[model samples]
Target: MHISEGVLSGPVLLSGGALAAAGTAIGLKKLDYDRIARAGLLSAAFFVASLIHVPIGPSSVHLILSGIVGLMLGWGAFPAIVVALLLQGILFQFGGLTTLGVNTMIMAAPAVICFYLFGRLVHGRRAVALPAAFACGFVSILLGAVVAGAALMFTEENFLEVTLLIVSAHIPVMVIEGMITVFCVAFFRRVQPDLLPGARVADMAAPQERNEA
Candidate 1:
């Protein structure tokens, strides 16, 4: 959901930039040095995923694995997403520098929200984790669409139709993302259970301890 360079009004741009700045600070602080590698991989994944855009209206539809990033990286998703978005803007000219902050806020805010909302359940037992994973990915996109649409509408009255188009076009995308998240969650649970949201700091260490016992 890129807002382009000049589409947003001055106040709207300022609001997005301010909020994104705050989120980046918190994300940087919350991110541990140990997770730098994980963050990098996920950032690259998001960068690739968001590039395949299907034009809907003023915005476009794409596979944003925002929930997957949030589920794994927690608050780190904000900074992670920003870095990828920055490169996309600079190199590929996907969103542009001026709209970088807004696009980051649009994508990463919902990610953080889903992290808090579904993170625990996804880390829980099997019965709940699978469903939670699906919901996390599904709901994040829906919420992100809403925020993107609202951001556009707040800038001007004519974007009401565009806002509607954004939401409607993404409905299918939500389902696709939900399934992808579920598959990834399940695979990680089997191969690297500790990496999936339940554990962070001692993820690998915990498995070693159990094996040693």
Candidate 2:
């Protein structure tokens, strides 16, 4: 969900900007060269998935697919999300420049959180991994909605209704994303387990032999 530029107060905007900067810095530091393409691909997916959205007051509702991003990129979600959001703002004007930081924080924060929460579970048996995958998607949306709501609330107390509406509107998306995550995770586990979080760089490349040596 993208929060409109003028909707947030100066202090709120500054705070969001600072948090985003810190997250992006950490994300960049932790990002592996081997995974750059993966991050770019996920960012593109996020950008496309959110292109079709329904505006609700200052925010919007759409498919974030953030769970998959987090599962695949972990801390790298910050930089990936920031890039997608920046492109959306510059190209389509879906979100404005001034609000970029807040919007990025709103979406990426939950993604990073989900990676920590459910990343390992996805590596477990089917019974555990499936539910964990679903939760990763479902909870990321829920948390994102809450974060969006909080930003609005902090901006102005009168936006309570809009905040409620934003959260309520995203309920269906939460379930849809959860199922999408489960399917994606299942597919990746079969064909490309190395793409998931915690996959070693050695595993990503050909451990048998590498030009890096």
Candidate 3:
């Protein structure tokens, strides 16, 4: 999902860089003090997960695990993902330094969106949470593909075919991520529910709800 260097125009790169900077600032501000340890762990998970990629045609699909990051860390995913991607870019050259901003946005923006959209459902109850977890995983990849594709199309009209092909290649990844998210969420929900953002919110709200009642 990384946009290679020199593919995007200066304006596109600048705008993406600006957006990523702003997002990273917000993410750092929003990081919970008590959850710092958990955030680091998730960051490590994200860093490792992307290493194993399945090359398909012109695009390579990998286990982003972005949904789990967002669902657990909220806006914190931006900073965490940035760190991981930075290391990946420097060490492995999976993506270039020039395209770091756009690549981070492509992956982390959808994660934040999923946190807002499906987070509550994932924390609601087991029956509802499983499906919501699945949806979060499924939708994040789809949204990331759309954003990346749109960015590419904006840079060059001729990239239409490549955009479509990349999007298509990730369809399998969407399903894989969904199933993985479900199992991961279920495990956390049972073993360490506090690690999840939704669970934290629900737990905090319970006191207020009970008092009001």
Candidate 4:
């Protein structure tokens, strides 16, 4: 979801910009060179997935695979999201430059939250991992909607209806994203388990290998 330019108040925009800047810094700090490729892949996925949008007032409905991005990249989701959003703003003008910080926070905050909440659970057995994956996706969208709604409301009370509509509109998307996350998690678990959170093959090497490296 993205909040169009000029919809948010100056204070709201400043706050969002500050938070996004901090998150981006932490994401860059935590991001290692080895995970750069995965981050790029997910950033591209996010950029493409959100390209098809159904505009609803100032916001829009789209795939927003932020949950999957977060599950794969952890705090790195911040920088990855910023990159995609920046490109979208620059190339497509889908979201304007003035609103980039708010949009990035809207998507990336829930992503980072989901990463911390469900990172470990995804490594569990199928029975547990599947549900966690679903929840991760579902909750990420839900929180995003709330954040977007709150931003609008804080900007102007007249936006209450739009806020409600935005949340209502994304209900189906939340479930769809949940199922998509489940599928991705399952597929990755089989073919590239190392891609999932806590499953990095390099990190799991034996103590001798670690010392040698």
Which pairs, if any, clash in model 4? none
User: How well is each residue in 1-213 modelled by candidate 4, as lDDT tens digits?
Assistant: 789888899999999999999999999999898878878887887788776664556776668888998998889999999999999878988887778888989999999999999988998999999999999989999999999999999999999999999999889889878988999899988898877667864456756697899
- The C-alpha TM-scores of every prediction are 0.87, 0.87, 0.88, 0.88
Residue 24 in candidate 4, Cα distance off native in Å: 0.3
Who wins the lDDT comparison?
A: 4
Model 1 pairs in collision: none
Clashes of 4: 0
For 67-116, candidate 1 gives per-residue lDDT tens digits of 98888777888899899988877787787777778888888998999999
- Measured by TM-score, how close is model 3 to the native structure? 0.88
Query: On residues 137-202, what C-alpha lDDT tens digit does candidate 3 reach at each position?
Result: 999899889888988888999999989998998888998889889998999888988778667766
Candidate 4 CA-lDDT value? 0.88
Query: Model 1 segments beyond 4 Å from truth?
Result: 49-61, 201-212
**C-alpha RMSD by candidate, in order:** 3.7, 4.8, 3.6, 4.3
lDDT of 2: 0.87
Report the C-alpha displacement of residue 171, candidate 3, in angstroms: 0.8
Q: Report, for every candidate in turn, its global Cα lDDT versus the true structure.
A: 0.84, 0.87, 0.86, 0.88
lDDT of 1 at 190: 81
What does the lDDT read for residue 133 in candidate 3? 91
In candidate 2, what are the lDDT values of residues 48-151, reduced to their tens digit? 87666745467765678888888888999999999998898789888777788888888899999999999888988999999999999999999999999999
